[model samples]
Target: MAFPKELYNAKFVEYIESLKILYLVDDKFKVICDDYCSSKMKTEKYKKKFEKYFQHKLEFENLSKELEDEILIYLIRKG
Candidate 1:
């Protein structure tokens, strides 16, 4: 579940997030992101939401796969 640190950009992030893909497993499965339901910028809404929800930048934050795919990735591929 680890990739090059530099590849973790808004687009890639959004791409993976939208895939509804889950990463890591300790007890069953954990979502990596949020529902990224916004159209503008895609990641901006989540960035702000996470910042407000968790009080931090979305970049440094690790969300559930649901939120990650929903909020980060696009609809074409699964990152």
Candidate 2:
């Protein structure tokens, strides 16, 4: 399911406005904001960039979870 277009647009605009304020406050934020703005050039391309970032992050978490399970099992056996 997808969010309603109106809600999505409103939220996006709100985020952009907040980012603009952040950009004004710090010079460093301007560079990241500029990169984010440029990434919006093409729909699928931008989507892929976001997807790739989250996929890598989730993969790391999954690996951590596996290790945690292993440690718990070992501790239980030793107890």
Who wins the TM-score comparison? Answer: 2
Candidates in order have lDDT scores of 0.48, 0.68
Model 1 misplaced regions, further than 4 Å: 1-40, 56-79
Each model's Cα RMSD: 25.0, 12.2
**How would you encode candidate 1's per-residue C-alpha lDDT over 1-79 as one tens digit per residue?**
5522433457766666533344333323332222233233467767787768665445346555567777656654554
TM-score of each prediction:
0.20, 0.41
- Worst-scoring 10-residue span by lDDT in model 2: 1-10
lDDT tens digits, residue span 1-79, model 2: 2222332344568586565566677768766655554554456687889999999999999999999999999999999
> What is the lDDT for 77 in model 2?
100
How much does candidate 1 score in TM-score?
0.20
List where candidate 2 sits over 4 angstroms from the true fold: 1-45
Model 2 lDDT, residue 9, Cα = 44
Q: What is the lDDT of residue 13 in candidate 2?
A: 81
